[model samples]
Target: MAARYLVSPRGGRRAYPDITSALRAAEARGRAALIEIAPGHYEEALTVRGEIRLAAAEGPGSVLVSRPRGAVLDAFGAVSVHGLTLAGRDAAVDIVGCHTGTLTLDRTEIRAHDGVAVHGRPHTSVTLRDSVVLYGRTVFTGSAGLIERCRFTDAANNAIAAIEGARVTVRGSRIEGSRIHGLRVCDAQAEIVGCEVTGTGQAAVVADTRGELAVTECAISATHAEGILFIEQSRGSVDRTTVTDALHGIVTKSGAGPVVRGSVFADCRDTGINVQDAGLGTFENCRVTHARNVAVFSTKGGAPEVRDCLVSGGNVGIAVTEGGRGRFARIGVEDLAGTALRVYDEASAAFEDVRVERCPAGLEARGNGGTTAEVTGAVFRDISLGAVAIDGQSRVTLRNVTAERGVMGFAVSGEAMLQVTDSEVAGVSGGGFAALGSGRLVARNITVTGSEGLGAFGTGSAYVDITDGTFTDCAVAASFDEKAAGRLVDCVVNGTSGVAVRHNGLVDLVSLRTSLPVVRHKEKPAAPPQIVQVLNNPVFNGPVFNGPVHDVQLAWNNGHVVQQQTEGDGTHP
Candidate 1:
């Protein structure tokens, strides 16, 4: 029953006036053909080889197949184009050579004034269901396609392009207003499901070079650039995608590697997941909101692997600069205006179970001296400033960390190097672990509670070494000013309302136990011996222990007056 042919410009006698004489009287009645086209304009420029079924008896813009120049349906093999309205200048549905059947364009209405508006080659097999491709660009070189529910509008270029070894599958498509890139895959292999790319001038899904993309549940919006763009050595996988108001949301650079899962980058103006240069990615369960800048930006030598993420209101949430390196697990950065995880130049990062809340600053490792940050089980809450801020010549390490209600909690300055173990600094207003300038702090079993100020601070030529420490209710529980140097072993300064150990400089107290009033020697006469070297058994009594002692030690077990002096000629013992 494949042999009906009736095309009319009213040339009667069983009607076959145009449509290339009704496809040459159905190819001399030698195979499959059904060319029923009756109503209106047909400027003729068709070359269908063999099995054809070109319908449009009166539906769909009432048949208008205009040519004016090259390609107006030049399909080979089994072609089926229903409800026609194909107009062209060059390529308005041109499925070239060596076609292995199938070139169906159901409910068609493709119109190109310049170039491509559906041009498939390389053993072509294209099927665009519920079609409506307008104004140029819809190329598929090594074709093998299926674009269902299609409607690519106002595209002068790239509103669907699958290069070289193309094998495309775009389902539920609706790409609108694309001047450039609303779906482009270079060394082709694409699978975009439930797509809805809107208002794109550039990059609303582009996988360059060795392209291979799979964007599922897609809904990319208003992209001027980058809403899923994997450059050069592209690799893919972006599931559950939803990128809104994008400038940059999902951009994996040069040596691209993508594995973005459960994505949702909202209100992005810049960087919501940009892994640069030697890019490599693995972002799982992502959700970056209000990204005005850096919600997840790994620069130059980017190495990303962010897991279980949720970054909110960004100015900077996850920024691994220049020589970037990342491995952030279980992240949750909230309400950031700035600095909530930024590892500067010569970068290196590794954070686990991270949580930074109400940020003004939390986790800022500065550059130059090769920055490095390693945090485990991190939690910095309501940080208004300094909740782990290590400066240049950086090297930071915190294990099982928690800095709560911070104004300052772990702020190590230049020539930096900090190592905090089993950390905890609660209710800080200022100084709950601060080592300035020539910074170097190594803490273990740390716990500084309710600090209104000073619960472990070292000034200028800073150097603090705290072991088995705990300073509770601190206003001043541990401070070493100006040419600073410190070492508090097995320390415990409990409920200090003021001065528990505030030496103007140099301090080394082992097994020092205090409940307020330990030492406060701010009188640095020509500075250099504001020393407080108290050995082993220390349970110092009030009177603000005016310092200047070399090796003082006191002992008195049970009743606990255990203070012992070894060699103290200059004062206070």
Candidate 2:
């Protein structure tokens, strides 16, 4: 085995005073000398060969290499560069075609011009550790290399491109201030961890893969497109990550879906997660909030498993259309402008322990959609309009859902059938349940409570079987209006005027149960509670919030989101 060579800029009294002369002398020495560069501006393009160890004192200010006209450094054979600066260059630091060798850089700085960077392809191992690649434009390619703990800034185009069959691993780094994508992985398997990518025109990480790609402990923000995107046969996963201030928080291109877990998506213009085509994955233990369009979009294609997620502040929480399905488990969706979990267009959905709250219309099904939309053990509270609206002949099965404070708790319009069993509806604004058009309602063991407006209003509905239910504290607990008959069996109506019928209507009352809110007169009401909890994460805070202020979700979420809080042991759930 051959020994390592060195190239220094300084020399002894008998030798030269700069690195070029020292390198020439070391070449005369046949090999094996450690080249340590001092703090000086090297204004020349350097070319190195053989097995060499290249180093510098500290960062770019210490040993700066400035070649503005062209490339600064070129190397061959097995080489390692540490703490060197290739600055003021208008071209690439070409590594050429190194064969059967390892090229490594530690704490080096590369500031190149448009369409330039270290292009070493189809060769040996290349690594950059704790480096910086800044102020580069990419008409050709800015970066196609393996890097870690790096920072890329002020990119005019695509910052980094992982070519076909490239193994690019970017960890504990940042990609920001880009005119285009921060990281573009094309036909490669990528693994990115603990990184922050922001300020892009398109996307943060566009991983075009043939297989698996993983991004863990990262933050993606302020992109026009999705924050994390996977295209073509690529499977993606994100754990303990955050995406904010994006047009779409996450998107999977055609034929790809990612397993997203332990993440947060906030303030997206479109959906939190958009699946464009066909694939299958899972999203567990995530939070999607402040979405303007839809929270979770399984619309175009690709059915994914969603579980243990909290979704709030959106138009539609989960919209499954265009032949997509979902296995939803333990999810809570609230405060929507439109419906919550709208499944239509031949999309099948299943909900297990899901909560939909505070929406205008919740759980709407239209256009022959959702064959297996079975709701089990869920809660719907503080709804404004319709808790569960059905249209276009959708078949839905409900089990043990509590709907409180809504205009119409259940409205099965458009000739739809609803098989509801063991549910409670309380404090509804308009009515407890309403069924319009010809449909079948097989309701068993239901409780309607607190002032139902024409408690059970139906028209053109089929024979209703109201078996084993209770009604409490409501005036006109049961009523039928236009095109239905009344079937009163073993039913109980407490504190209500008797059932009313109007205009060829139908009434079916089996049983009912009601309860009132406990009245408590307090001496003083507590002060209005703060809505947001102050974040205490100190990582990447950059002198602890001394940097520029970014978004409003960190500031005005009830005033405590941006404020610094005392150190309380924050264990994330």
Candidate 3:
């Protein structure tokens, strides 16, 4: 067995001259040894071949180890170093190759000029506690490492990088001012907790390549790229974190699945949360704000779910496109310059209990073929162009929705289908509800009031079916073009305007009542060949029949009605 030795500049009978000589004598003994260095400066590189304990006699500042040529300490076997400061022109420490036991560093400080501070090789297990690495990066390849209570600063590249089967854990660490990612894990696994990472040129934390990374209780900000990036089939969990001032706060890319909870992402230059390329993201109790683009974006075949989230101050609050699918619940969006929620191009989504206010377009869905959306208990107020717009062969259903102060409250066009029930559209500058260009609408229990234009307008071969609704205070309550068709069943149209219902198209009126005169027949250049009838109904505020008079029972109808037009050129019945 080798005997422990102490090294000091003041030579004594039992003390060695330097750490190099002590290490030599210890290795020759063929056993474990402890070399205690006294307070002094040593300018030499020491490489260990066996188990050894090298420590400062007092504390970290008591002894200084500097090697101008190479690494200060290169350990091939089990080694423990404590309470020392190592400054190297090259690497400060390297733990390499087939460690039969554990390697540990405690209360140490390392300063590297050109090379990395700490490098771990394959088949090594290393641990660092209460350490500081300055001006260099740390790389762990195929090694299992643990880092705790450490501070890393001013790295030219990634502060900590784990690659190729490395398993690393970092806790209670502060990493700052890195040129690239603060912590990067590729083809490896990592767990980071209670860490603060800031001022990175790239993503603050990157997890890629089938790796599992868990980050909790962390603060990441001021990153040029995403604050947290999960890509290339990586799986991760991020919780209780605050990320701000990044291009994107959190991004899931290319088949990644990440669950984020209890987080706040604010003031991002781009989207606050972005999921793309078939990535699946789940966010709960998250708040995102002040994004320049879409606040939460799921596109390029991604699917995301957001619950209890608040998104505000963006061009679009949430956008799902390019075959994306999402579900949002209890979402509140306000003050958007563009559409609050947009689903387009074969995308589909469901929104419940959503509230949108002060947006140019509240909810818009446009698609070429296979887009669909369902919204329940949604309220939109103070919009510009329109509150809800559905177009391009898409379909949307809105229930218990309320819209106020918009141009066209609900606009449907281009063969789209919209069903609105238990909804209200009020204070609209244009038509309260419009169906244009082969669009279809099926509405029940809907109310429209205070529209400057017609309350309901259907044109260009559009179809509208009102099951039970009311329209008031508009130029014309219901107006349909010649090519359009609709039916009003158990509905009421009342307005201060002289005309309540005007239709050049075919409108089936069943139990329909109006407070203003109904224009049964429009005055065309010539009376149409078809015979029109004027009903003698008392529910109308004005005359029910205006065109012509026919047989008494034929003039009015529920079961039987007469068809006659006083203007000539049409046959009377």
Candidate 4:
């Protein structure tokens, strides 16, 4: 029959004086043992080689097991401790070796001085339920374990660390005041659900694994460093979590792919979410607020896809740099301190249905060497510097965009290329379109009105081709320098204070209608403007062609007409 050993502080019938005596008596019989301890403190160091169940005869706080120096229990076979307080200097419980050895703790409290509270080695597993660990570490290497409803405080290292192919599941747990990470998994697998980790010196939850780690419905805050870090070829998912008051809310690097869904990151010292160094991430329906730096940052080939996200009150809302590529759709950035969207370096992005409001400069793309951006259905309003700024050999295409109440609209400089279609730029303090320094712009079906400067201004070898456009109430409808080039076809210019077209370079005006004069080629003494081609066009207030006409069959006056010529030298159609 299985032995039942009773232990008490005082001498009694069928009772041993100490717990170690009862445990030794059961081990000698070679049978399963149940050792019930009474309500007092028993100081002992025990190593069990057989199956044993050590339970308190009374409730918790009644049975205290204290070892002044070393570990309290080392079990090589099956061991269970229920409703007992274990106090020691070294590890309170160490489960080692094979043969399916298991250690189970139910309603137990483990207190240690400078060592781990529980250590599980290879082939050993530990299970904790409704337990508390104080002033110690918990490490499981090459082992598997489960922790439920546990609280850990004042850990010297990580409160709970699983490494070297260990698998651990922690549910409804809390860890506080850990010097390092509150929970760390390295080269292993971990699943943390309904956990809260606060006041950690390093990352609250850090997993640098070759396997997977999952965290669900967790709150991590008050970390000295990043709140959560999943890096080094790890794959994971964090869902419905909130992180606050950290240097970085979440950081993913080194080829890690972590999916974060339905999360909120607020009051971060640095970026709310940082993806770097070939890491790929996906964020959906998330919100970031009050970040000191960029809200969403992707750098160094980190390609992130963000959808249905909102960023408010941050520096740069979304920044992609250093060969990074981002695909953002249906995102809104409001009240930003710097540029709402910034793409630089060799990075490229595609944005769809994005809105930026109350920012300094919205949608800035700079190519130090190579950068590109394609934006569709973008709306920018109440900006300080300009709505869209593209420079430095970059190429940007904006389709179905609207810019209102900005300093300037569509500022393209430094050999850049900008193509905008079906867009409107109105109520801008500066020119509606400013293309400078060898830049190229191809715009179609654009409307510009209520600008403080020229509706379209080109200078310094810039090339502009605007077709099917409307310009109203501008300083000048279109102005081009001597080195610039432009072609306006089928456009209507009305209610401008200055001349409709002030051309000093090569200009072609075809099928243009205006209440003001259609074309005025400046006859500068140094560099004269060339009206290259005026085909099938009527002018209302134009000076007659007084200079030497290249094509004598076409004459220009207030009401001009073309005369037919012979086919030998001059011809008119």
Task: Summarize candidate 4's per-residue lDDT along 143-217 as a digit string, tens digits.
Answer: 988999999998988999889999999999999999999989899889999999999999999889565789899
**Reference-based lDDT, residue 3, model 3:** 62
- Candidate 4 shows a clash count of 0
Residue 78, candidate 1: Cα error in Å is: 20
Q: Candidate 2 deviates by what RMSD?
A: 24.3
Tens digits of lDDT, candidate 1, 1-573: 798888989777688888987887777776999998889898887777789888988877798888777666677788888989888765434422225666888888888866677777886888889988886777778989888998988788888889999898999989988888888999999899988998889888889898999999989998888888898988989998899988998889888898989889998898889998988989999899989988899988989899998999969999998898989999999998999998998899999999999989999988877789899999999899888988889898999899998789997888889999989999988888888989899999999898998888888898999999888888887888878898899988888267778776478889888857877674624333333333444555422356555534433333444343333465644
Clashes of 1: 7
lDDT digits (tens) for residues 1-573 of candidate 2: 443333335644453456666566666766655566767777766656666676775544488777657666666666777888776555434422233456677788777655545554554566778888777732212223567888888776777766666666778998898777887766666688999998988888876656457889999998888798877877768899999999998887577767899999999988897776775668899999989999988866677888999999978899888787778899999888888888888888889898887787778877664444788998888888877877787888899988888787776777677878899899986877667777656677887888457556566654455666676766566655446554645656666344433324235333333332212122243333343334444564322445564432332224234343322355321
* Ranked candidates, highest lDDT first: 3, 4, 1, 2
**What TM-score does prediction 3 earn?**
0.85
In model 3, the runs with Cα more than 4 Å from the true position are 1-4, 10-13, 28-34, 49-51, 76-78, 89-100, 450-452, 472-475, 494-498, 520-522, 526-573
Which ten residues in a row are the worst by lDDT in model 2? 514-523
Candidate 2's C-alpha lDDT?
0.71
Put down candidate 3 lDDT per residue, 497-521, tens digits, no spaces: 6577888748887888886887766
TM-scores of all models?
0.44, 0.79, 0.85, 0.86
lDDT of 2 at 201: 83
> Which of the two candidates, 1 or 2, achieves a greater TM-score against the reference?
2
Q: For candidate 4, what is the lDDT?
A: 0.85
Checking candidate 4 for backbone clashes, the offending pairs are none
